[model samples]
Target chain A: MKELTILSGKGGAGKTSVAASIASVAQNAVLCDDDVDAADLHLIFKPEVKEVHRFEGGQVAVIDEEKCTNCGICWSYCRFDAIHTKAGSGFYINAYQCEGCRLCERVCPSKAIHSYRNNNNYWFVSDSRFGPFVHAKMGAGEDNSGKLVATVRQKAREIATETNAEFIINDGPPGIGCPAISSISGVDAVLLVVEPTRSGLHDAQRLVSLTNSFNVPVYGFINKYDINLQVSETIEAFLNKNHIPLLGRWNFDVNIVKAMLEKMSVVEFAPEGETAREVKKVWEQLKSLMLTD
Target chain B: MKTLITSTTSTPEGPFDKRFGRAAWFCVLDEKTGESTFIKNENAEGQSGIGTKTAEKVVELGVGKVISGDFGPKAKKLLDKFGVQMVIINEDLKVIDIINRIKG
Candidate 1:
């Protein structure tokens, strides 16, 4: 199956909206939201969760007060300063500052320290209107979002392969950080959702170079291209210089937000609308490119 | 007793590496003989877990003490488990300088 990720280096670049609409057109595709930190695609798909799996991001050390010996070995050895003393309770581990390395647990001479896994993160397999969907939720200030992205993508791939689906489309996270890298890695192609703003072009440039480094073929569409005609021209010029294919130039429409409020993808929300037609064309272009191989 | 010092190069005169896990080389010094040997860190440029991997290697090398600019939390934990002493020296000294000072 062909795997494609929708990415924009900058946030609010319409990655989720564009990806979700494209999923409606790519009817045989398995869809996944790789942005675990602040996932939004589920709002459009309205998935019914089939499986829920907890993710242990890392281990946090805990001190047992019953052991009674106020030994300071754990306190001294804690590189993260996670171990702190309370007035009557003695030492306690600060879950926030804890790096979850379990150093203090190993160093405690009295064996008062033990480690526990942080299970605040979870991934899900679900049935959406678009097909099997995989997504995740990360706890606030949780570590290992990158690993969680991998897990979500893995589940999506397994489901796609099992169902013999034609495509695996991911709504990727913003920026060139860990989660973004995890989202794009080993994917057959990347669909860049570029917004026509100076900052949008700037961030898309970074994302473009990153895709280049990963050697992933990139196809793009300018979301809200009419919002800034001059910047759109510049962005188009840049994409042309880099030899990245431009599939469609879309207009800025309030219908996107209206479609979300109605809990529908653009294609489903407005079947005969201009945006839906363009998105369908985008999907057709993407399918020809990915299926050509 | 043997002590390990993180270094930027595989030479006694090379600048000491401030970072522990990403150091280019580690200089192992035999305190009794005042002899030092350099071992390149193969996992220096690796992504994630290199600190713990390097710590495991140091424990396998059977060093009594380790000196570096800083230690990652995971590395510090693993080394402490094996009773490997960690010494953080923030000074910009050469590997030979650390060896002489520690030997003395």
Candidate 2:
């Protein structure tokens, strides 16, 4: 199967919109939203969850006060400064400050401190209008975003193989951080969407560097290229310098927003529109390029 | 009794380093003998766990006090357990100036 990912180093650069549009056009595909931090592609796909699984994050240490010994070893050994004394209360762990290293629990002389896994994260396997979908939602301040993303992708690959799907398309998270790295690992190709703002160009440069370092093939396109044509040209020059192929550019259009509000991909809402036509053409070209390779 | 001061360089003339973890030098001052020695900080450029490393060094050296601009939560916790005193100096000054102030 051909595995493709949609990523933009900068947020609000149409990664989701482009991924959703491609999802509508691709046949025999399984979709995964690797943005567990804020998985929103499912909003457009509206997946009916077929399977649900809990994701266990890092371990957090908790101390029991009734154990009768205030040896302070746990307090001394806590590298995160998670242990705090509250007036009358002897000690408590500040969940926010804790890195879940489990050092405190091990150093506790009274065996009062015990570490527990953070299981407040969940991932889903479901069916949407476009195809089979895999996505996840993690609690605030929960660690292990990269691991969660890997889990979702693994499940997506399983469903893709079982159904004999031709493509596994993923909507990746923003920035060249952990989640983004996890999304593109071992993928066949990456679709990089860039906006035409100064900040957009700057972040896109970072993403391009990251992708190239991983030696992953990248196909780029500019979203809202008409808003800043000068920036668009500069982006084009940059992509040319980097030897990354520019697939196509989409004009700044409000119809994308209108289509989203109507809960439809641009392809589904306005298949005959100029933006939709360009997207269709790009997907076809991208698919052919993958097949030939 | 010994005190540790975060410094920018391994010399008395160098300025004090406000950050404890990334300091380039650690100055150990003997209150009784009025002798000071500077030690290079190997963890100055470390990306993570610098606080823990610095604090562990302070504990191993058996310093009674630490003077720096700020201390991270992790370093502070370890130092507090070891019963080491902490002093924060926000003003930009030379290492010599701080040593003089301690002597005065």
Clashing pairs in 2: none
> Each model's TM-score?
0.70, 0.72
Candidate 2, residues A1-293, lDDT tens digits: the string is 77889999867898899999999999999999987766779889988999999888877878888882776777888887889886875788888888888888878778898888788988999999899999888778975355666678767877986899999999988878656766765576899999999999998899887787453579999999999999999999999899889999999888899989988898888989999999989999989987776
The ten-residue window of minimal lDDT in model 1 chain A covers A142-151
DockQ for model 2?
A: 0.01
Using DockQ as the measure, the top candidate is 1
Q: Where does candidate 1 chain B have its weakest 10-residue lDDT segment? A: B43-52
| Per-candidate local distance difference test | 0.82, 0.83
The number of the candidate with the highest TM-score is 2
List, residue by residue over A31-96, the lDDT tens digit for candidate 1. 989877678999889899999998877677778889838878888888887878998857788888
Rate residue A77 of model 2 by lDDT. Answer: 82
True contacts kept of each: 0.00, 0.00
Residue-pair clash count for candidate 2: 0
